[model samples]
Target: MLKREVETAYDDPPAAETVNPQGASPYMLLCEHASNYIPTRYSGLGLDAKELQRHIAWDIGVAPIARELSRRLDAPLVLSGYSRLLIDCNRPTGVASSIPEISETTAIPGNQTLSHEERAYREAAFYWPFQREVGRILDQRQAKGTPTIVFGVHSFTPVFKGFVRPWHAGILFRKAERLGHALVDALQEPGLTVAANEPYQIRDESDYTVPVHGEARGLDAVLIEIRQDLIGDRDGQMAWVERLVPALQTVAAGALARA
Candidate 1:
């Protein structure tokens, strides 16, 4: 059974509906899997401690990098507060992976056989509102004739099953070829293997970043995937941000110059 309650240890900063007081910057950062927090409401969907620790539950090392990147760039960030186990912010709300009945090979007692109403509640409560906030930010920027660059940050496990992912970072995108290419080129560091859409590809199936935000608005966008092991600690996360921030600024500045 799923129980909803409050977790004092995990306090949500504010509702997604609330805009950042500093206003939006030309660069907008998004971290879909920021927190592995399960609202006391669902008691973590019966996941074990280890499962919560897995990359499937959250993007390890991504939250800190996203936060640091936002601070360093003075950009407003939109992040999901719940664990992907409850409802994946990256996947479309209607997809099975969005609210997984089974994740990391463990069956979730609460997510199993979720009724239409229950699914809708989660979608409306968590998914839609979060997305609406992004849309609001974009609309405001557009109205002001300020072009914006959308960057989604994510982290993947170094080893999945028996296979090891070798790249330090990867980029995912569909038609924003110029923007994507520039970013990869700028991030070319010694011994750093940068994959251009290697591990994951941006397609129609990609909901949050490519669909509703990028393609929908015809904005220059890219999704960056960092190796989890490289960014699991504070030192590692900062190092990545230091490397990525400059590349991003260069790409954004180049794009704006063309426009």
Candidate 2:
């Protein structure tokens, strides 16, 4: 099984040039829950067709939107290829929440109890590389004397349990940065309620991106979450790309200006 050929289970190395290169400045964008692919290696983890489609597997619409946004903004994007069920790429390998057995009401069969070796295998194969790559990108950019502002892009399900998340978009940040706050202000859509880390808060125990890349390095970073329904389709994705480009561009510019 170690050498198994599963397309969705493994992540291909990023291209020599970043997939999406945006702006002349050093700001980078990332979408950790960007893909739903299961790397055919796991055979859907003994799940039914419907089970694989749940939010437990991936954050719907995030990959494509992130790709489009990267292309539109010319920003480098480090996206994960495996489903979160295999092992959440954004989480630390030792964290229980890294590979959740129960996500909302859905049960992930492949994630049931197993040997310590099994856990370590998933961590080594999928989780570490994804994170290390992000770290490497940041390091290289910083070494060039470029200020890095990491943007974490993710999408959430519209209806969870019974209650609905009302905000169209929301921003999560542990430390206040001038650029992040300005982005929230610029993204004030008429019907959209932009939450400043509502629904969830950023803490060291659970968050991987902020602690590892942002807070640890003292670089400006903001975790941006968009409701999945909005970007679930091609048209909606384009609309979001357009809506967010100027604001992100302005925010990127603001980061440069601050330095």
Candidate 3:
């Protein structure tokens, strides 16, 4: 591949937003699919406004929950500011899904048959910066001898491909299986359904954040996926935040004890 550097200028919002950067908590929250904003330059990726608002553009309600959880837990949170349709922050760069031509059933007209310059521009403009910011924070914490656990917050559609999903929430992990299982067990309740790695699983080709930033550094990490229908509103988001803050705290404590 020829190396081409594109000079990216931001007219919309920033590529990433970090909150509570000074927080002392061991947990670091990441919302990779936080926003559904396509830069005006992209012209909504050749889709209507309605399509951009759909779950394909972003995780439906993960951003608010992540913010509230960060506030409640006093952990630093990092959020990507562009639509996943532009370039999925959680997916590996140069992959098919990184800049998906088709998300779900909707075809992205703007993403079709791009030149190398276009692909590199999107990665340079929107993708790499977000990943670099997360890495910088992790580096700072590691340098300070602070123990850190990476938590990726996401939400899934209640129904996917005409099949109804019964999981209220899911915890996804690969190498950090122990932490993933602990969180899955911690989230169990009398009637609430929590599954271990459902809807989607993390892989090198399909994911970037957990594998590159968390597992590569040998830090405990997990991705939490809530059903979108459950967290589509403020009340639901707050409720999940309340439920998750404690569960995450308990799990972190247990991990520390074992460490």
The candidate that wins on TM-score is: 3
The alpha-carbon root-mean-square deviation between model 2 and the true structure, to one decimal in Å, is 3.1
Among residues 3 or more apart in sequence or in different chains, the pairs in candidate 3 whose N, CA or C atoms overlap within 3 Å are: none
Candidate 3 lDDT at 3 equals: 42
Worst 10 residues of 1 by lDDT: 1-10
Estimate, for each residue in 1-259, the C-alpha lDDT of model 3 and write its tens digit. Answer: 3243333344677889999987888899999999999867678989999988899999998999999988989999999999999999999888889999999888999999998888887888788889999999999999998989999999999888899999999999998888899999999998899999897898888988789889999898899999999999999999998889899999999988898
lDDT of 1 by residue, 1-259 (tens): 2232222244554325232524445787788888787767577677777778888788999988888788778787888877877778778878778898876566788899988877876776667667887777778877788888888899887876667889889988777899898889999988999989967887665456777787789887889999998998999999998998888888888998899
- Weakest 10 consecutive residues of candidate 3 by summed lDDT: 1-10
Score every model by TM-score.
0.90, 0.89, 0.96
Best by lDDT: 3
Q: Candidate 2, clashing residue pairs? A: 8-39, 9-39, 21-74, 21-75, 22-73, 22-74, 22-75
- Model 2 residue runs over 4 Å out of place are 1-23
Reference-based lDDT, residue 201, model 3: 91
Ranking by lDDT: 3, 1, 2
Candidate 1 residue-wise lDDT at 156? 80
lDDT of 2 by residue, 1-259 (tens): 5542233323543211245443444657777776566645567877876888877788887777777777777678888866788788667667777888777887777778856777877776677777877888888777777777888888877888988888888888878557667888989878878878855688777788877788889887888888888888899888888888888888777767767
Error of 3 at 257 (Å): 0.8
